[model samples]
Target: MRIEIPAKKRLVHETRVPIRWGDMDAYRHVNNTIYFRFMEQARIEWISLLQQSTHTEDAGMLMVNGFCNFYQQLSYPGELIVKTYVGAIGRTSMDVYNAMFLTSAPEVKVAEGGATMVWVDLITDVATPWPEAILAGLR
Candidate 1:
């Protein structure tokens, strides 16, 4: 099946991660909790890249909400291509989406997930509006 990201979302980042043997559960498949970590790694990597380009100090993002859905089982010793997408840029928050596919089977998504990310002033610990550079980095 052809999976389409919503029109409102923009593909911002992509990375690949290897599935480690320790990531598996007793069922010999990837544990459900590890999927969240996989997504987190991709998101943090993307955010760090964005921060470098934007050069925003004491400014970052927080995952206010997050969720995931598993489509197919994932096993060990495989690389997964994780794609990150952004949607609905609000004043201080936006939606982030992630999709993971095994490198050996790029067309099939093993899992998908998302989080509502809020821009924040780390020093003040308060939500803040998206700066131009952050917006530029995403768009």
Candidate 2:
């Protein structure tokens, strides 16, 4: 199925995560690496919620690839709200999109990103088709 990445109307889930001291960079702002962490948190939350609703586990979803675009800077002692959603559900993988905005400056979008995760067998570490439960939950 073709899914248009929503321009504004839909945000699958929003999560608030605190900026920790460990996240501070040499410039004294939340490190660039930390932004990826925030994205991961958002993605996991989405996956976990979907799993809970479907009575399944997230171990089946593996992070095969991901990326981020930093448009603005965020400093310490701030809260980040991460918005996430399923961008597409393919035969063996799914794309999860995300956007991060500083709660302190709700008007500013700090970053936008997405990732490709493949359904896999943890033991075998091989790609597999999207599980029926996950596909159903996406709908």
Candidate 3:
């Protein structure tokens, strides 16, 4: 049987994360919630790259929405290759997609997820337009 995995677009960033024992559940598999943490780790790295390139001190993005779908069970004593991609860009928001695959078999995806991030003004707590540098970087 063949499984239809979701197709991803251009890659924005990728990171490797080792599974910790505490990340597992009673079932001896990685907890579902930990998938989000992996995505967050990749997202932070992407943001850090952007910040370094733009040298901007402005407030970072706010995650307005997020989701994850599990395709296969992941166990500890392994590492994951988490990849992030740019999906869609709006005036003040952009969609970020993520996929997690076992390092042993990079072609086989274990989980997929995404999040909608909104640019916000840290001081006013209001949505704001994406900075030129940020938009360029995301493109």
Model 2 CA lDDT for position 47: 71
Best-to-worst ranking by lDDT: 1, 3, 2
Preferred candidate (TM-score higher): 2 or 3: 3
Residue 73 lDDT (model 1): 91
Angstrom error at residue 95, model 2: 0.7
Off by over 4 Å in 3: 1-8, 52-59
Q: Which candidate leads the pack in TM-score?
A: 3
Stronger candidate by lDDT (1 vs 3) = 1
Q: In model 2, where do residues sit more than 4 Å from their true spots? A: 1-10, 52-59
Candidate 2: worst-modelled 10 consecutive residues by lDDT: 1-10
**Model 2 pairs in collision:** none
Off by over 4 Å in 1: 1-5, 53-59, 121-125
RMSD of each: 3.6, 4.6, 3.7
In candidate 1, which residue pairs clash? none
Native-referenced Cα lDDT, model 3: 0.84
TM-score of each: 0.83, 0.83, 0.85
TM-score of 2: 0.83
Q: All candidates' lDDT scores?
A: 0.86, 0.76, 0.84
